[model samples]
Target: DTSAFIMELPAYHLPYAMTVLKYALDRAFSFVKRAGTIIFAMNVLIWFTSNYNWTLAHVDASQSILADVGKVVAVIFAPLGFGEWRATV
Candidate 1:
């Protein structure tokens, strides 16, 4: 029914809808780009941290790099009511 209504909209509305859709798509794409940037940063950081121990040498997994960073982030988010970093990371 929603699609039917959209399809039946007058010719004049087509341009409006197109413009709105274009704006919406542009905004959505910007969001995707930002999200991608954040994900890329996190992945690289996490990988670097997990793979290398302090002094830049191999070590155990639990005492890895990501743990420290994740703990900090978890505390930051704690005030928002989601204190657990396990699920976040």
Candidate 2:
């Protein structure tokens, strides 16, 4: 299949320095906000999973739900090396 398109265009001119800076800063801040929120959420999840058992009781890391899940994953990774539950996690 083939297609052709036509478009009108405005003449190009250099952008204002302040306008470019502002646009860059706005995009940077937006990215930082999204990345920060995701990191914060992941940290919270890791903390919760590593500190609580399936019953929700506070527990040591080795006894937490994360450890149980990691053990299962560790088995899958065993043939590839680094099979320890802690390493898997």
Candidate 3:
């Protein structure tokens, strides 16, 4: 197993291997603990971008916040040949 290799059970001192394992486990557990918060924040951003238009009205998808943002970005890149707002979106 990867954990076994990382711990080096037979090669390294038990305390050192355990210290490494503890660090790895702490990082993994922290990610798991923070996963829900991260997903919730991303979903809120996506929802805001997808549901609201430039005028802040709940309009059609084409007029959503993301589309407006894309159009603005596309203008900056238009001279570089990326002209289609939809493509930029």
Candidate 4:
């Protein structure tokens, strides 16, 4: 079966695989840190533009509203720290 074929792969290969992955990830993170600022700025700009549209459409325009929206999105996407971890602390 295919499972037996997969099982034949070396268990010792994991350390080597992880070492290569770590280096690749380090380089990827460095590239992102150098180049991702522009992407982050663009996303913030888009958020502001969408908010402006909502304002023009007679939605409530308040700092608290936007702050809450940002918080909700952050909670949903980055829930690990902002959710159970923070709640227990």
For residue 5, model 4's alpha carbon misses the true position, in angstroms, by 51
Give the residue spans of candidate 2 off by over 4 A.
1-10
Q: Give the lDDT of residue 7 in candidate 3.
A: 45
Q: What stretches of model 3 exceed 4 Å from their correct place? A: 1-19, 32-39, 79-81, 86-89
lDDT on C-alpha atoms for all candidate structures: 0.76, 0.95, 0.82, 0.59
Highest-lDDT candidate = 2
Q: How well does model 2 score by local distance difference test?
A: 0.95
CA shift at 80, candidate 3, in angstroms?
5.2
In model 2, the clashing pairs are none
Model 2: per-residue Cα lDDT over 1-89, one tens digit each: 23356566899999999999999999999999999999999999999999999999999999998999999999999998968999998
TM-score of each: 0.53, 0.83, 0.54, 0.31
User: Which 10-residue window of candidate 2 scores lowest in summed lDDT?
Assistant: 1-10
Candidate 1 or 3, higher lDDT?
Answer: 3
Tally clashes: model 4.
0
